[model samples]
Target: MHIADLQRLITRDPGRPRLTWYGDDGERVELSGAVLHNWVNKTVNLLVEEFDAAPGTRVLLDLPPHWRAVVWALATWRTGATLVLPPTTEGSAVVGQEQDRGVADVDVVVTSHPTSWTGTSAQLVAVPLPALARRFDGDLPPGTIDAGSAVMTYGDQIGWVEEIDPTAIAVEPALRHEDLVTWALACTPRPTASEPRTLVGEDHPLVVLRRTLQALSLDGSVIVTSVASTTAFADEPERLDRLRATERITD
Candidate 1:
């Protein structure tokens, strides 16, 4: 199913809770389907109508792992842009075997820092979360985005890539259950209860993980990709403890 289809489901059932944002203090903010849909709509309007973002246009997203990422990602997909994510914000040169899989080529870069653009030479724009928050009075921006386009990370810049043809993108109507089934089949190969160290790698383990969780009929699960360094020290016991403690609130 396309991202728009998923958004439509939420719009149809606005009260259904779909996302839970956890804080370091164990505080949580629940994003109900209806509320999330509205937020996405606002965000879509801001990006598309306000900024003139269109399908196949790349929009850089430099924000952290907030609920906004999820919403913006869905909106980008619906609009037909290929969403890009930078490996890190420190502006390190691409290195190691994992660099190839980190950031894909794109036309725009979104960064939190207005100065110091890094990584690619794409158009740079800063989406200051604080400024945005103040602008909206803590509410998400306004508008609905159609899938078929995507919002991805460029380098440290944020703007639009106009080379893509919006007319070529399409959104499948029934993607949820079908995607669930696909995820179930893919995640079944991993050892579920093993030490966390084994899970960290330059691999797409979550693809398989999603499949496994789906098979169990689990309604929700957070899959942490190995970007967290603590999992590498799982054998050290204390290190793993600290890492686990840090992530426990989200779990």
Candidate 2:
């Protein structure tokens, strides 16, 4: 049987809010399973149609722990592409320099940068945070495309595609689709049915991804706050309590 974690989750509960994000700049975003699934589908189409990403294609995801990053990761797997995570400290580097290291040995690189990239030899897709209304500044390299714009042109339903091998390497360290789903399920807490859980910490992609999946696996929602906001709440517990968060997962 084919294993598709995101697809299965969306199928199970399309209307439930699976992921919620709060940024330090007071930016907030919420994604229901259906909406997240649509983004993933569009991304998968972009990878397959524009980037020629097929099964086993190496895709380097060079972005912070934001909603867009999560969407790209799921889209990579859905398209049967191998997901390559950047180094832990890569997020701190300057944009151009960071792409040099992160894009190495990968067929495609999807990044969240403000400006267009003109360096990488690999297929580059720019996913600007707080997507701009105008085109990105600077000359884009050949094969570079704005992901924010491209995804909007694709269909929400991913058409016929090859079934993904459950045991295939989805991430490093022998992590497979089945393994990822199992880990997320294990991390999930028992359902309380009263209030959603809360996740607050640094922008770590793995932790954010896992926590989001954990909440979804139990048909529960989550409120993910920035580390700064979380720290502020530490001094004012009542403020955190006012959000009605049933549980708190911290770094």
Off by over 4 Å in 1: 89-105, 118-125, 128-132, 135-251
lDDT of each: 0.42, 0.67
**Model 2: clashing residue pairs?**
none
Per-model TM-score versus the true fold: 0.50, 0.78
Using lDDT, give the best candidate's number. 2
Estimate the TM-score for candidate 2. Answer: 0.78
Tens digits of per-residue lDDT for model 1, 12-84: 6456445544323333456666666666665555455445566546555554544455556555544556555
lDDT of candidate 2 vs native?
0.67
Using TM-score as the measure, the top candidate is 2
Each prediction's total of clashing residue pairs, residues at least 3 apart in sequence or on different chains, is 39, 0
Residue 92: error of model 2 in Å? 11
lDDT of 1 at 188: 36
Lowest lDDT 10-mer window, candidate 1? 139-148
RMSD per model, one decimal: 10.5, 4.2
